[model samples]
Target: MNSRGFSRRDLLKAASSGFGYLAFAGLSSMAAGAGSKASPLAPKAPHFPARARRVIFLCMNGAPSHVDTFDYKPELSTADGKTSNRPGRIPGAKLMGSPWKFRQHGQSGLWASELFPEVAAHADELCVIRSMHTDLPAHPEAYLMLHTGNSQFIRPSLGAWTLYGLGTESDDLPGFISIKPTGRNGGAQNYGSAFLPAACQATRIGSEGQPIADSQIGNIRNTKLDAAAQRLQLDLVQSMNHDLLKRERVNPGVEGVIESYELAFRMQGKLPGVMELAGESPATKHLYGLDDPTTADFGRQCLLARRFVEAGVRFVELTHGDWDQHRGLKAGHSRNARAVDRPIAGLLTDLRTRGLLDDTLVIWGGEFGRTPHGQNADGRDHNNKGFSLWLAGGGVKPGITHGQTDDLGYEAVEDPMHIHDLHATVIHLLGLDHERLTYRYAGRDMRLTDVKGVVHKAILA
Candidate 1:
């Protein structure tokens, strides 16, 4: 202040407008660091020996059909056009067979349909879970269930919980990031901290359907003050924030603000560079299918995910919606698969070559699986009974298919993994005990599993 010939109040009064956005991010980040000396985002040791150091969820929004994709139901194909003998809903629905042909891929000989030929090339790396179920078939509730483990009540998301447990590896980036998030179904709650400390919340880059190149963190840039000037202004504001914290004793809002300010300051320079894909080699671009228009958007997202993880961001979720495929199952599913197939395969290969795959858990699936029975001309209704999701790397047994659906692929007949089990297993892979990772809230101890979760030990390596 003396050197600049400005008092604390002078700088704040001059820069108050520019600093308002920082507080907003701070509130949203819900970061820890309030009421404590150490950063809530500071990296910490895992509870026990760890299998995975980080997580990347490739969320295929709008339920994808199990029978057409990973769950090869030959029986359904043979019985195509037969009435759905299975049960209560959809009285006269008929069974549908995949138009796409399924074939064995890799040495594992796991079956993958023609729609995802590129992903099938890496079949040996996948641990396909054929028997998966959730509580509901509706998008909103099921989406919430997948991300937060509970749809009825508010809760911290898996990403938020992970950040709370392990903290972030990067001080320059958010601990958890959701790129191209659709922000629908559950919207912010999908990555929200709920009752957890605000520090654990995610930093969103762009929303779903938005082009990655056009996406930017709003208000991160300040035209009024240069770097040096911003620093002075930030210090003054932070001092006020800390003072408020001292007075209040426990202020999560203030803590989040402080942390967010610091992070916003640090990341302003770094994040821009990360978003620029021009630095990547042409070969790298091709590998991610960035050269093609059909794949460019999702490819860009996948590339960003790789970049963010390499920079030490803890959790990154990649969203690819439009998987619902209710009616035009053939056209819709084909296009969706074509867009992401090569990029995903390339990501797995890139991670392996870089040695990230060994300790980085890669998850791929939608909210739930679609019904085996056909809906209209080519559509499939939502089915919460049986589905499939595949896990790769992060200490999962390679080249194996876990569990199974019934002959018609309508119900999970063996080793059925509920949403809670998936959450528990995911946490387990990251070296946190699902039961032990609890946050006390609302007069009871709360957890991601919400009192019902059994880790799928059979899938573990």
Candidate 2:
């Protein structure tokens, strides 16, 4: 102030009068049917041609057993009930064969258990990675690794990176959405944007025990003001923000605030219709298993994911779990699979029929997988040494199995793909090079893969 020969008070007086006219102009523009100023979510071209326009992550929260589900190990069944002396073994752990039988399905001849009969029907569309390995055995660290790439440090999630690299295609909705996300094991941090702009963070739809339809952005509706009144108010706020931004020079947080306000204003007229399931046809509802009580909750979540992707949301994640079956493994896994199988199948089939699958990447897996050896008499413990996850569409080779586990399905025997590699591959599919897609933070460039990722090109179509 002293250098410029202008006091703070003087600046305030000038801003107050100048902003009044600016606010009025903004309001007039709104009245004239002009949209909000250039949105932060305005679609941007990817680094290169993108294979997938969107991604839908089916997060099976608890570690599902690979040996019992997709990785068929004949030796494990042949030597069932045998004692194991492998490293990291829980003292007297015994090798246990799957209670369910695996059968070859589809023209691709992919092996799947009876537990996932519905998903198996779509086996030809899947690119199952059998040798998935991660560093941690516990849920918290493993889940964090799966989402953020680094298990120990807090960092921007994969979704945040995707949003940061390529701005949202949807202005009315969030670029990244996590529906019915888990409340435990890192909680919101799983989708939090750590160093990236706050607006890049995921917009959570539902949480544990809450009906998905009940999910709404906080303070989305105003009781005191109608649409026109709200527009007037918002215009004034945006003018003040713009003035502050000019004075501040550069502030990510302030910029985030402006973007958030703009998005919320636009969402008022659009979000309600997008979230309403009543508008969906009876056939669509039945297809997603919304007619049945058991599958209704997950069915609704899956259907919403589809809707969000169709609405141009860049990334959508649907979480279902408590698949960590340490006791009553058979009963628990069966119940868990049954609840999601039909809905998952419905999602895939619907996407294919709607022609969304061609450009939408669909992923299915848990944080880690269960040990081949028994935990209790009948249950298995966590095993980060080997696991399985599957992908469909989005330029992946369909109906092919990539990599392999050992005879007992306890470790990745060949072409092991780590969590970092998975993240790299995902970004690659979205037309991003993980090595180059980085942000400057804390004096150095930070990336989702964190300097340790290699895209599995063999799986690419």
Candidate 3:
């Protein structure tokens, strides 16, 4: 006691010791401000009725050559080893014809090359966009463009934008999850939440060259303390954080930290069950090509992606890499395709059989496509003027091809779809008007589709 009574400092100092419980209770209630919410990942309704509830992105990391895969150019084949003149061509660059054979398949009779025979079997389900183009030819810039819409600026990724527009359905797992992500090119910036809340960033599951089954969350289990003890510790920490928050102004970063802690605590109870593959049947395992060494790694990624989306994870990305074939195109593409072919087919088939296809959008593509012009003896150069990507499920029109590349597959001559347009179309399918889904940051209202983007209604069902 000072002069008349005990000082505030004395009370605080005492509370810091044995009287901590009293301080904890008081601070907790103050932090919660009336009726507080439990999680930031709680499900929220879309801006309008949505066709797709979740999205799975099969990122074929290095640019895949559209001329050899989906787009068939007979004129280029005719001009094979001789080239001399095409606008934008290096003066003496020669034309290169795809060595793979193109065939028509399914009731829709979609044109697909032998490079993706397994995927071609599901031609009726795919919506192939042959004239997909972006701004850059380089991997880093093109990758950033495809993921964040702007190649030069730091911006929130597509997954981050989706989470902001429509809150996630899963409370125990993170809304955005990236499996086997790469460290090259744009790196984490591809999935990073630039100006958005930190919680919106993707939780990386596995690294390149690491098997998904072998991946484990860091610091997930606490062997030192039991559940009850852990809870007590967490509550104490939360209370202290709340007291600090109350003493200072409201900080978004602080709020995000609190949410992350609460989420991590909740995930310990649920995430293990989802990650475990022991419960899956033998036939299912074989279907994912887990029994085969060549397909096993990518197969595991596909299967895990299915499980995640089925469990209500808003966005899940599976990456397959080294598709950039500047040399040894035939051998490289063949090897890369073999690694992912069966697994991709199995994923689509599984999703269809499980009836998840109606509400789940599956996207397959790379940063850009390869040029029709020859680089080394057999390989093609990078082409940003025209490429291809395909979408299946969700509300997309099945068994259809939209847009077209010119005779030589050099550029998008008909109905070219830019990266911004693709982003706009995706959000539109999810029932978000790209124009309205804006976040005020820095000075103006920023959006996924900056100032341009038109929804390609032709592809919608």
Q: Write the per-residue lDDT of candidate 2 for residues 264-326, one digit (tens) a residue.
A: 777767777888888889999999999998899899999998898999888888898889999
Candidate 3 error regions (>4 Å) = 1-39, 247-249
TM-scores, one per candidate: 0.95, 0.91, 0.92
Write one digit per residue (lDDT tens) for candidate 3, span 155-263: 9899988887887877677788888888987788888888776677787887887877789776667656555445555555565666667767556566566666666
Checking candidate 3 for backbone clashes, the offending pairs are none
**How much does candidate 2 score in TM-score?**
0.91
Candidate 2 wrong stretches, greater than 4 Å:
1-40
lDDT of 3: 0.83
RMSD of each: 2.3, 6.0, 5.7
